[model samples]
Target: MFASNPSKRRQMILLVIITFNIISTWLHYTDNALFLSQYPGPEWFTSVGVISAVVVMTPVGLLGYWFYSKGIFWLAYLLLGLYSITSVSSPGHYFFPMVTPISWKMHSLIWLDGIMGVLLIGFLLWSSVVLKEWRSTSVGN
Candidate 1:
C-alpha cells in the first residue's frame, strides 16, 4: 500500500537498499565468536556489540520504512542520504581508483559499504527529479 502511490517510488528503492543494509549488518555480526575475535575482550563490549548493533540499526530501518510509507519520502530519503555518505566516507583510503579486481578482494567491507553508499546516493539524486515531476503533474491533474 505504501508503494502504490506514484510519488513514492523512491520509497520502494530505499526499502530495497535499507533491507539489504539490515541483512548485511546482520551477516557481519551473526557469528559472535568471529566478532569477538576481532576485538580485544573488554568484557562489556564483547557482550554487547552484536546486541547494540541490532538495537541501533533495526529502529533506523523501521523509522525509514515508516517515513516513506507515510508519504514523508523526503524525510526518509534525507536520513538515508546522510547515512550513505557517512558509510562510504568512513574509509578514507578507498576513495582513489584501484585498478585491479584481485587487489579488490581484500577489502570486502569497505567495498560493500562504499558501493551501497554510491547506490543510495545515485537513487536519491535520480528519485528527487522523478518525485518532483510526479508532484507537479499530480497537482496539475
Candidate 2:
C-alpha cells in the first residue's frame, strides 16, 4: 500500500522491528522456566510461570506492535526512547542469567533497543520530509 520506495522501506523496517521485539520477548523467558533462573524453582510455580509467561507475552507483544503501527508514534518513541536510554546506563550483570559474566547480552539488548529508537525517529522525520516535498511539488499542478 505504499506509494514510493521510501514508504515501502519504512514499512519493512517497522515490520522487522515489530518481529524482533516479539521474538525477544519470547526468548527472554528462556529454557521454559520463565527467565530461567540460575537456580531451580519450585515445581508447581515453575510450570505455572512458564505457561503464564507464554500466554501473556505473546499477546502482549502483538498488542505493542499494533499500537506502534496504528497509534501516535511520538508517544511510543517518547516512552521507548526513554527506556532505551535508561537501560544502557548500567551495563554489567544485575543478578540475572546472562550468556556471559561480562553481560554482553544485556549490553547488546540495550544497544539494539537504542538503535531501534534512533531508526524510529529517523523514519518519522523522513516521512515528514517526503510528504512536504510531495505537497510542494504537486501544489501548482
Candidate 3:
C-alpha cells in the first residue's frame, strides 16, 4: 500500500514508473544488441557497443533513483531525464533503413521504450507541480 499523503503517493508512483522505464529501456537495448542486423544505422553500431551503452546508462538511472530517495529532486530530475532521453530516442530507429525487414517484436519494444520514457517525464512534471504546491502551502503556514 502507498501513503495517503500526496507527496508520498506521488513519489511512490514515480518510483514504480521509473523502475519500469529502466527495465523497458534495458529490454530495448538488449533487443537492439542481440539483433543488430535488424537495425541498419551505422557500421560502428556493433552488438558490443550497444550493450556497453546499457552498462553505462543503467547506473545513471539507478543514481537518479538514489538521489530521488535522498530528497534531491533537481539532481534526480536531471539524471532521470538524461536516462530517459535514450528511451525517448528509441523510436527514431524507424527513420532509418533496416537491413532485414523489421519484425513486430522490435517494433513493440521500441514503442514500449518510448512510451515508458514519456511516462517518466509526465510523472516528473506531476511531481514538480505537487512539490510546488506543497512548498507554497508550507511557506504560507
Best by lDDT: 3
How many residue pairs clash in each candidate at the backbone level?
Answer: 0, 0, 0
Candidate 1 lDDT over 1-141, as tens digits, reads: 745665566456577887776554454344333544443223454536655755565676567557656656667666666556534552443444443432332356545656766776676667666545324433211
Higher-scoring candidate on lDDT, 1 or 2: 1
Pairs with steric clashes in candidate 3: none
Question: Which order, best to worst by lDDT?
Answer: 3, 1, 2
Better of 2 and 3 by TM-score: 3
lDDT of each: 0.54, 0.44, 0.79
lDDT for each residue of candidate 3 in 22-107, tens digit (9 for 90 to 100): 88989999999999988757777899988888789889988887776666777878888898887888998877878898888889
Candidate 2 lowest-lDDT run of ten: 132-141
Worst 10 residues of 1 by lDDT: 132-141
What's the CA RMSD for each of the models? 7.0, 8.0, 3.5
- The segments of candidate 1 whose C-alpha lies over 4 angstroms from its true place after superposition are 1-5, 8-10, 29-54, 89-106, 133-141
TM-score of 3: 0.86
Once superposed on the true structure, which residue ranges of model 2 sit more than 4 Å away at CA?
1-8, 30-45, 71-93, 96-141
Top TM-score: which candidate number?
A: 3
Q: How high is each candidate's TM-score?
A: 0.55, 0.41, 0.86
